[model samples]
Target: MTTDIAVPKSAQSLEPFVAAGVFEPIDIHAAGSLARLITGLEPEIILGAALAMRAVREGHVCVLVDDAYADIDLSDNAKKLPWPTPEKWRSVLTASPAVRVVEPSETVVVAPGEALVPLVFDGVRIYLDRYYDYELKLADFLLDRSGSERINVDESEIEKTLDEIYGKLTGEIDYQREAVRRALTGRLTVIAGGPGTGKTFTINRLLKASRILDGGRPRAIALAAPTGKAAARMTEALSDGEIKATTLHRLLNITPQHPARFNADNPLPFDLVVVDEASMVQLALMTQLFTALSPNASVVLVGDPSQLASVEAGAVLGDIVTATTPDPDSGSVNVALADCTVTLKRNHRFSAESGIAELSQLVDAGETEAVLSCLRAGHDDVVWIDPSNPDDTARVEQETIAAATQVVNAARNGNAEEALEKSIEHNVVCATRYGKFGVHYWTDKIQNELLNTILDCGADRPWYAGRPIMITHNDYLNNLFNGDTGLVVSQSNSAQGLDELKVIFAQDGELRRFNSSQLGEHTTWWASTIHKTQGSEFDRVVVCLPEPPARVLARELLYTGITRARAHVSVVASEAALRMAIETPALRASGLVGHLRQSE
Candidate 1:
C-alpha cells in the first residue's frame, strides 16, 4: 500500500542536508496503517511488514533504531492507532518465535521448520543464514537492498583516465589560475625570475586564466612594464583584438623627468593590473601605481632583481619585499601592500649551462667577480685576418681589385665552399680613397672589377647585380644598375626590400678626418675612433687604429672596437695604439690581455 505525503514548508530550511542526499521525509502516521493490516499474519510476517513500512518511509530498505523498542507493551494493541508508542509496538514483535533479534537496524525471519531466515518486505526478498551467529554485514545488506551491479575496468585504462582527469582539473584556465585562486581564498604569492625567464609569459597567462574563471569577460585589465621599451615589447607580444597593453608611463601619462600624476581621484580603470620588467621599477613609480589602483583591483609585478639597473644601490626586489612589514599606525595599508608581492623563479630563455645564464645566476648570488669572469670568456669565435700595408691609396686600390678578383675566382671554382657551407651566401667589397690632409674619396674600382669577373665566369646568368655593396660616407645610397644588380652606398640611399652583402671601407684621410657626416648613413662604415663602436657587433671587423689618443677614453674606445668582431677581426694600428691598449688601466681592468693569453 502507498500513501501520499505532503512536504512541510519548513523543508526549505533543510536544503543543505537535502542537497547532500542523506535524508528524506517520512509520514509516521501512515506507517501505523501497514502495521494494522499485517496484524493477523504470523509474528515473522508481521515483523517483516513493519520493516518494509519503515523502509518506504525513510527512502532506504534498512531501518536503524535503538534496541529500546524490543519490549514494546501492546496493552492498547487492539486499538487501530495511526502511530504506536514504543511500549505498544515492541511487545508484539518480540513474542514471535520466528523473529530473531539482531543488532540495531537488523532483523531475521526463520522459515517454517528451517534454521535459515526468509525475509519478505513488499516487492523485495532477502535470505539470511546464521553461519556466524546473528552478526550482519552492513555493506552486504545495503548492496542487497540497493540491487546495483558493479563493472570492472583494466588497470592501464583506469590509470590513463585518472591522469587525464587530473590534467584537466589542474590545467591553467587563464593568467589568474594561481593568483586569483589565492586572492579569492586570501593568500599572497611572489613571482621572481632572471633575464629571459618568461616573466611576461607568466603575466599573460594569469590574465587569460582570470578571464576564463570569472565567467564573463573582464571589463578591463591593465598592463604595465618598468620601462617604455619593455612595455612596448610586451604590448607587441600580447596585442590581439581584445586585450590592450601599455607601458606604465604611457598608461599613467608620466614622463621620465616629471612628477607622477596618478592619484586616487583619477584611478586606473581596470579590475586587474599586470606589471612586467618589474626589476627596473622604482619605489616612487610603485607608490604611484598602488595609489591609482581601483578599490577591489589586483596587481601583479614581474621582474628579475639581478638584472636591475640599480644593483649597486641595493634597490633590489628583496628590499621591496622586506619593506612590506606591517606597521601599527596603518593596518589596512600594510595588508594591501603585502598582498601585491609575488615572486616567480624559473629561467626559460637560456640553457642552465650557458655562460650568460651562469652569469645571471652569479649576479643574483651577489658574486660580481664571477659575472665579470664570464664576460671575459669573450665572443665564442674570434679570428684575426691581417693584410700588410701594401703601400698607400694607389697600392691599396690595386690590391683591393686583386682581392676582389681572387674572391670571384674562389666563388666560381668552389674554393669558397667552406663559407658557403657556413651559410655565407654573399660577399661585399668596399673600396675608398684617401687624399693628403683630410680629403676623402670613394673608388668603385674594385666593385667594377668584381662585376666584370662575375660576367666572365657566367655567374651573371643567375643575376648577381642585386648583391649589396655597402659604401659608407655619410648616408646610405641605393641603386639598381640593372634589374638584376643592386648597389647600396650610404644610409641616405637605402631601400627597404632587399638583402645585400655589406662592404666597409675606411679611407686613410677619412680616418684622420673627424666629420660627423663621414659616418655611414645606410651601410656599416669603418670607424676611426673606437668610442663610436661601443655596443655594436659585427660578423667580421677591420680596425685601423692610427695615431692613438693620449686620453683614457681613447684606450677604452679601442677595447670596445676589438670586442665587436664575432668570427673574424683584423687590426691595422700604429704601434702607439697597441702600447696604449696594453698600458691603459681601463684596458687591463677589462681583462682583454688576459683573454688573449688564455686563448693562446
Candidate 2:
C-alpha cells in the first residue's frame, strides 16, 4: 500500500529529522520520498520539496549509499555503490565547490582520513579551499593573451599629422580662422569686416576643408549671395569645375516669377552647402533653405551683418544675429554637423589706422565714442571726410569722372610716376550722395556715366575683351559686358568673378549695403557710400561729401569717409561743410578733441 506524508512550512519542524540524520544529506530518491511525505503534511511543503530538488539538480550533493548499506561505512564500502571512493567522489563533485549527503534513516557513515559529522550539513566539503588555485591559473592565462594581442599606436605622430594638415589647409589662426573653426564646430559664426578682409578667401578655404572631410565627391555645394552680383563673385572664385556653386535662389530653384511655388520637399543634391554674402539673405529665405536641406548636411554661412543694407528693414542680418543666443549645447553632439557659426575679424583690406574699422570694432565691443576716440589717437593719418549739401549729385558725378580718369591714368602711368611727378595720386575722387530719404539720384548718374566712360574708352581697345564692368545699380545692366577688371558697381553687384580689380561705387545709406560678393573682393578702387566705407580703405579716394539739412552728416560718417584713402584723400566740400563737421554731435560725442588734446 502506498502511504503519503506531509511536511510543515517552517524548517523548525524539520529540526528533529535533521538532528536524527534523516534529512541531513537528502538524495534525489529520498528527496522524492520526502516530497511525498510533506505533501500529506501541508500544502506549503511544496517549497521545501522545490529547494531539495534544486539542490539535487544543481549537483550540490549525491546519494552513494541506500538503506541496504546503513550498517556499513559508505567510504569503505564505496565499491558496492555506483561511485567508488576518492576518484568517483572527486568526479562527482569536480564542478562544484562542496558536496552534501542525505539519508531518510538515522545512520552515520564515515571514512578514514575524513571528518564526517552527523546533523551538521555545512562541514561536508573538504575541497572548497583548493578552488582559488584554479581561478588564479585561469586569470594568468587571460592576462598573457591580452598582453600579446596589444598594439602600440604612436599617438604623438597621429596628433602631429593632424595639426600639420589643419595648419596647411588654413593659413593662420586669426580671428577669422577662430571664428570659422568655432562655426565649423557648430556655433553661429558672424563675420563682419568693412571691405577686403579676405572673407571670400577664408570661406573658400573652409569649403575645401569641409569637402575633403566629407569624403564623398559631392556634385554641388550651395553658394548664395544677397544678390545676383554677389552670386557672380562666388562663381568667379570657383573657376575649377570641382565645386559646383550656385546662388541661394537658383539652388532653391526659386525666382520672382514663381514666387508662389516654394517647395521645401525637393532638396538639391549637395553634400555640403556654403552661403556667401549671407547678410543680404532675408530671414524668411534662410528659414526656407534650412527646411529644404537634410538634417545631416553641413553649411558655411559667410556675411557681414553691417552689409545688410539691401535687406528689408524687418529682415536684417543684424536682427538675426541679435535674435540668436549662443546655445550652450551647441557642438556637444558628436554626430550633428548642421548647426555652426563663425565670426571673422581683422580687416586685411584696410590699414589699422583707418578710424571707420576701428570705430566699428569699438561699437561691436560696446565701447563709448570717447573710448573709441582715445584708441584712435594712437594711429597716424586718420582723417575725417564729410560732404555738405543734401543735393551733392553734381559734385559726386564730377568726382566719379575725375576718379575714373585718375585711376585709368595712374594704372597706365605707374604708381611711382603718378605719385611723384603728377601729384595726381593725391587727387582722389569719390562719389557722395544724400541720405536714405533722398533718391539715389547721384549714385545712379555717377554709375551710368562711369560705365559709359569705361565702355567708350575701351570699346575699341584690343585688351577690352568685353572687360566685365559691374554696376552698383541693378537697372544699369553693365554685367552684360565682359572684361577682366570689372567694376563692382554696387555692393549688390559684387559677386565672385575673375576680376583683377574691383571698383566700388558708394552712396550714403546703411552700412550693411556694402557687405556683398562684389564689395568683399580685393578692391582696386572703392567708389562707395560714406556709410558703407566706414570700416574700409582704398588706394586713392576722392570725397564728395554733400551738405545735408540739419547737419545730417555724423562725425563717425565723416571720419569713415576720410580714412578710406590710403595714400591720398581729396575732400570736395565747402568750408562751411568742414566747419559744420567740427561741431557735429557725432564728433562731440566721440570726444575727438579730447583725444587729440591728450595726444598733443
TM-score of each: 0.35, 0.43
Per-residue lDDT tens digits for candidate 2, residues 1-600, read: 011233333333443333333333343234345445434423123223323333333222212211212222233334333323444333343332123332222122343576432111211222111111222222222122212211332334433433444554455556555544543443134454445576777776566545454454554556666455455456656544455444566677665557413344665555456777665564346646665654344455666654323222122344334323332444122111112234455577557666545644553343455433533354443333334444453454575566554544443332322322222233233324444212244444543555576544432432221111334333222221111123222112236543332232212111112223433223222234554433233555655545533344434444454545655444555544544543442311011111111211
* Candidate 2 off by > 4 Å: 1-162, 168-198, 214-219, 235-241, 260-262, 324-339, 347-356, 359-382, 386-400, 406-538, 541-600
Residue 596 CA displacement from its true place in model 2, Å: 42
The 10 consecutive residues of candidate 1 with the worst lDDT sum are 587-596
Predicted candidate 1 versus true structure: per-residue lDDT over 306-390, tens digit per residue: 3322211112243334334443453322233344444445556545555544533543454535534554555343222223344
Residue 89, candidate 2: C-alpha displacement in angstroms: 99
- What overall lDDT goes with each candidate model? 0.37, 0.39
| Predicted structure 1: lDDT | 0.37
- RMSD of each predicted structure: 37.0, 34.2
Q: Candidate 1: deviation at residue 327, Å?
A: 16
TM-score quality measure for candidate 2: 0.43
- Per-model clash counts, in order, read 39, 60
